[model samples]
Target: MTKWSYDTNGTPGLDSVHAHALVCVTFSVYILAQVLRRQVRVTGLVVTKFFMIHVMNLAMLKLEAGVWGLVFMTCTLLYFYETLPVRYLPVQEKVVLITGCDRGIGHNLAKQLDQLGFYVYAGCLQKGSEGEQELVRNCSSRLTTLQLDVCQLEQVENAVNKVTNELGNKELWGIVNNAGICFVGNVETMTTADIQKLITVNYLGPVNICKAFFPLLRKGKGRLVNISSNAGLAPVPEMGVYCASKAALATMTEVWRYELQKWGIKVATIIPSGYKTGILAYDKQATAERWWRSASDAVKEDYGKECFYAKPKTEALLSPDLSPILDALVDALLSKSPKAYYYRGIFSRALPFLYLHLPTTLGDLVMKVIGDWFISKPLALQKSSKKF
Candidate 1:
């Protein structure tokens, strides 16, 4: 080991290193201010001056005791890279396909992307339906409404053919697998058919679309954006089957990302929740009632009716605006270097960190507490002497 050396000026070796680290940190913060100032000019300046000051102070002390100034510099440079302003590709001449455009994020995205000058193929379950008509009426002639029930393979293939014919010489820029269905209920209360329905629409639907469109994506060198959920990251009460299906999609998205890298095709997943979407049944009470009715006698007896009624009556917490999700999707498609996962909406990132980073027991306790805030104990369980 090398002996510790003292500076002639009276500063200790460790103290000298700490001073160097602090100086590096201060310099990084100044650089950050310049970077962020530019970002503000371009992107409305969400980063506050106060935040920059706080970040500088935090970063300075964070590595004061460390001897490795090189490590500190490397981390600072990484931060600079991540914090830099995002650049988006020109929307003109881009042809993008979006599923589940009948409502919610898909619908909004189709319109927004259309407005941004992209030739949008808005896929709806029902052609000539009110939603489809609304899109056609509002969007330019560039936007086309296509019938796409993602669960149907024939429909997916037909859509591919139609798109291929339309593109002829040009290339497709992006595909957003926004089609999905959500069913909320206790795991035991959900019938096999119910679970299958969720899987078919949420998981298998994306698989079929991606599989069929892989060639087109490869040809276009385009990106694939899958609409996932925060529920997929953590176990949410009453959304067990829905969460599982999204989790499957999330996993497949990762695999697709790795597999498509060689082809220059980017794959991204948008993790969003608590947005006012058609998939979210507004009348939770009615949904609970439906689940209760569908439950077998054994399930009914085991859980009891009172327990199921505890589901939230209204999605009062869901945001009416879908701009955050739309912006995320746009980034996933148009950014030069798209992130593998874009977490949007309330608790989108936090829920995953809680589950993945916390101790199992602590995480479970926290989850249970959150669950209990919205739902009461099952009638049968309350009557039993045993505790969960």
Candidate 2:
């Protein structure tokens, strides 16, 4: 065997290993350049950038020349073909029920679906709230506002019954389990009640709604879309509870898809990057104050008040526009053959891609670096380190 060796000029010679290494380095540099050039919008699948990334990946795989490389190349080609849209379902005959229509993603999605000619059942937390009223005032007669609080079984049951009665001959074509909330605090400081509240609203709420509406979905052979977060795919500090709930939702979606395959019902999970949705707190200062007040004295002392109270210099890096997420939801609902997972928004695909595809150790290192940069150091840690 010819062992790997550097040439007399001290350059990496044209050996297979060296060639692969060179390609990998070049690929990394190109990706980084694109990321910077696009001002952090590299994740958007703009035609040119999308093709460039795939072409570069193909080049690197070709240089490596292995069975695994060939497999990846084949998968890449398949994905490229799968993206081309064709043969959409007729919206005029479809009816969709979307939870959390009181605000945020669900509210917008309900309006969009209604405009697209789907009879929309908009589930609002309150019967006469501004969101519900707005939908009633603006949307067509095809859109109906239902009083729904997913956390309550009674409410979910009531909504389902009403929707069933109104459908008459039409089956419910889709159900979007979009009612969810997020709480950001260290797990150690989070109260048991808070943890339970997060689980109930984020996880169990969807479960209850699904079970109640399953029969209708079967009748229609409808689509089930779960609005999950990127946090579920890539867990992070200060969001353990939220992440766990969404992770559970995502897993359940997969299981339901398999179980419901006999009924011809499709299941899709929309994993979106952080967006300025109603689910999140825009008033960071007020949120910090609430969390601080709720913390126990011992917990407060350990982490210190400054750690919890210091406002972020800038707003959280959340996308103000919800269009990316809306697009994904529409695709999942309307596409003739929907994807099992629709990763939308900036960093939504990139985070999961890195976590799932990279070697475990390398993935951990990258996640650690990202966490360290994004998360703040506790004041208690600084105090303890100073003593040492």
Q: In order, what lDDT does every prediction score?
A: 0.80, 0.78
lDDT of 1 by residue, 54-79 (tens): 46545655645434544554465566
Question: Candidate 1 local accuracy as lDDT?
Answer: 0.80
Model 2 lDDT at residue 344: 77
Q: After superposition, how far is residue 186 of candidate 2 from its true place, in Å?
A: 1.7
lDDT (10s digit) by residue, model 2, range 10-121: 8643355444445445545654674566423333454564576457565855676544454554465455445644346678679999999988899999999988999999
Query: TM-scores of the models, in the given order?
Result: 0.82, 0.77
Q: Model 2: runs farther than 4 Å from truth? A: 1-79, 282-287, 309-316, 357-376
* Candidate 1 runs further than 4 Å off: 1-41, 46-80, 282-289, 373-376, 385-388
Clashing pairs in 2: none
Q: RMSD for each model, in Å, please?
A: 4.9, 9.2
Best candidate (score: lDDT): 1
Local error of candidate 2 at residue 120 (angstroms):
0.5
